[model samples]
Target: MDYQNSLAFAQEQDRQDPLHHFRERFYFPQVNKQDAIYFCGNSLGLQPKSAQMYIDNEMYKWANLAVEGHFKGEEPWVTYHELLAGGAARVVGAKESEVVIMNQLTVNLHLMLVSFYRPQGKRFKIMVEGGAFPSDQYALETQTKFHGYNPDEAIIEIFPREGEHTLRTEDILQSIQEHGEELALVMMGGINYYTGQVFDMEAITKAGHEVGALVGFDLAHAAGNVLLRLHDWDVDFAVWCTYKYLNSGPGGTSGVFVHERFGKDPSVLRFAGWWGHNAKERFLMEKGFKPMEGAPGWQVSNGQILPMAVHRASLELFDQAGMENLRQKSERLTGYLEYLIDAVPVGKDVIEMITPRDPQARGCQLSLLVKRNARQLFDKLMESGIIVDYREPNVIRVAPTPLYNSYEEVYRFSEILHECLEGC
Candidate 1:
């Protein structure tokens, strides 16, 4: 597994990789008929090859069956979302009834907030990790305001002590203890978007529950990149998008998870729609809404089939390969990336790894804090056909996806980065 500045060693690792065959399942993005070394799977995953066939089938059904497609088509457009649950459950480590493929990430967050963030009197405070994705921060702020609370006072933003890029587990646990009395809910990303730090979910969940506050996560960065056990960890809810790591295409359909414990709670207060109504009674067009007794009860409408079809297609591949296999490859692939990044002479002061060094504490992403123009370095890599992503200011994110990226790709990227630094 230690390639150690050895290209031959890297190639040997690739040759021996059991999951190497899974790389061919994706349609690698290319220019001039060559497969690009795509390390930006953290931003957007390469499309699964089966996605086309799945969408094509749905397209043909829609074209020929028209309105009848909902009830009579082979897949039954009316219940298309149901097809996604089993795969999603496996991905997030939840029961089938606890996972639901529904609206986009942000919308689902707002919906979960409706049920979980019931600010009452002294316990009106909501806690969110500092430096959360902008969309999540905005959602929390807006939701707090909607409840007639000043965001500054009601929303507690927990940050690492000064000079730390990532929060310490102890700091998070302590914050939860200090604010537990006033906290209504604790919402955080499973893996931080920028630093790639995977939070201690078990600790967070237990702390939040001890204070009688609901806990949830936005799993956009973690969904397919890391293994989760939401059910055992006692997470109250979670939301995630399929574009990143899930390889469901850009801005594709999203999913939600609600603990089975809350499935029948009438007071859960979801934003209901026809799709959420009991399936058997749906055709009856009953005057009142009787929600399906699971996470599907949160659905607002039948999901757009095109995107869900693509997601399903991607999930089929994931189901076949199994997450354990992916995680095994991922650990080694990402470790190789870390080793390469460290081997190159970038000057210790010029480069710092913001991601946790512990394998279990991070996914495939390695967020580099560059001292100079990170964007310039990023552009140079792009020109040289080594694709990586740049966050604003001076950070470059390199995600060597195990499903497609090779150890050789990581070594080549290091070589290019070293060359780029030499010119500057």
Candidate 2:
């Protein structure tokens, strides 16, 4: 995995890559009809070439058949979301019945909280990691407030110990112990969005369940980037958006997972709609709402075939390449990026990688903590056509996605980043 600055080495890796054929399936961004170095999948994924056809087929079916397209056309629009279930289940490691494709990320998180975050007397606190996504923070604060509880008293935030840039596993477990008695839910991102640190979900779920609390994860960053076994890990619930590594285009439809243990539990509360009613009797015009058994019970609206079709195209690619194979390539690709970044003489002085050294502790993203002239450095990289994302304070996130990013892209990015630093 030694990344030398040469076209032959990159072409050699490309020739040997089993997943290399996948690059042709996507519509890469262009500068004079040549594909740009696309390393920002952590923000928005490249569009699949077939994505337009997927939507067009649906549009044609609708135009030709009108309302009858729901049940008449090929891959009927009626149950279109169901087409994504098996691939979704496989990606997240859950039972087919345990997964459902529906609303966006924050909406699904709120719905999951309604069912899983039922707090009792004294056991009302929800645990989350510090520096969580602003949307998650707002949702948790509102959820606590909706339940007649104050966020300051009912929400527990975990931060890293002194001199540490990330939260340690023992620190997280110890914090769980301190609030175990009063904890009602332990919900956090599967991977930290800013720091790119993957949390220990299996251990955290075990600890949370031991304390009589429900556990869940916001897998927005980890879903397609890392291997997840939500059911095997005994996670109570989880949610994710597909626009990142899943490559489902911008603001694509999101998904959810509920472990089979909650399959037949009628005690769980949910905000239900007509879309979640039993399909067999759905058109009977029944007055009472009878929700589906598993994660589908949480859907609050009808499926929009447009965005969901984009997700279907992306999932097909994931199914073809397999997540295990993706992770195998991802570690080496991101590892090479890290190695080259660290190899620069002044790389460590002007920029610091906040991501963990262990590959298992992160995905493809490496967040750089810049000391001075942060925005200027980021702008220079961008002007040179290295497309990475900049967080508010002082971090620039560079994600070399496995499906489409090449080792050459990583090497090129590192060289440009080094030049940017030298100029600064």
Candidate 3:
């Protein structure tokens, strides 16, 4: 599809867009007293207009029902987390029973690592992509240290070839096979946070299993942004936060997907709590820990109502938009962003896209590697009311999300960027 660099063309696209209305469902942050063109959904999503109403409902329930809210309200606090399972499962392409909306992303990662990362005998090494998000790197390091293994020796960091910005899928699969013998677990981000590169999780998971290694992914950037089939991919375990593309509030609730195989196994080792026990016998105050049927069995505590209320508000929007529809619009929206960026002729040395060109290999984000005055350019964007984000060293990330961003906004952003580039 040929893209034109004109406001009229962008307006036409917006006019025809099916998901365009979703943009109005959110309140954009003001810049210079006007709505800023927000391209920062990859870092934090815009709050849903209905979020306050959802919060109010819960607040009212607590005010009126008090302790009885646990069992008496329309959505009982006791089973509140369960209300999110269907939406969370749909977003990540997992069974309802296999998905649990709980804990933060890093916390869930640690919990999943405890259950999946079992290094024994001669096989003790963990393989991960080099320069992973700091949280993942730290989690793997501490887990290895906890198991009495030297991190440098116990973790293998695979990097791209000398000049490339993204990992080749073939290279990753080959590396997995080469180190198959010593590999105890394969941990990677579904989408690299820095480069916005989406890894081939299905192939990676298959390769890991072939080597007798358990596989998992950190999908903080993938969930609600890309097409995922964790259950179909046979991913052992995965975790993600909802604050980014999911449009939940900041520091929002997270979700975990445990394959049915593990969820059904009562003997599986987990740091369980009272809520993870059987619901029928929860009030018995029993001495033994009898696990629930599926992913809920891994819960460490009862549901969180306030955060989940806000989450539920956003989930309702996802239910209306549909992931498949969102993906279709996302490809076009992000592809247009790339086309406009390339047309800028910013000079390859000055600025270029580090994100994969293939729409299938990326989500809504395009990471621009600015060789000169990266921070200056980012600040200019903010000052101009174009809300994007900057990463360390020299990368500026912009994500024109399908739910809230319009084509006209994307066009305008390029024009502002062109103006901003002159001074930088």
Q: Quick one: best lDDT, which candidate?
A: 3
RMSD of each: 1.2, 1.3, 0.8
Write down the TM-score of every candidate. 0.98, 0.97, 0.99
Best by TM-score: 3
- How many steric clashes between backbone atoms does each model show? 0, 0, 0
Q: Model 1, range 264-317, lDDT digits (tens) per residue?
A: 775678788998888999989879888898899999888889999999988997
| Runs in model 1 lying further than 4 Å from the true structure | none
Cα displacement (Å) at residue 191, model 3: 0.2
Error of 1 at 213 (Å): 0.7
After TM-score superposition, what is the CA distance of residue 172 in candidate 2 from its true location, in Å?
A: 0.6
Task: Please provide, for model 2 over 186-304, each residue's C-alpha lDDT reduced to its tens digit, 9 standing for 90 to 100.
Answer: 99999999999999999999999998889999999999999999999999999999999888878889999998878667567788888888888878978988888888777778788
2 or 3, which is superior by lDDT? 3
Local lDDT at 127 for model 2: 99
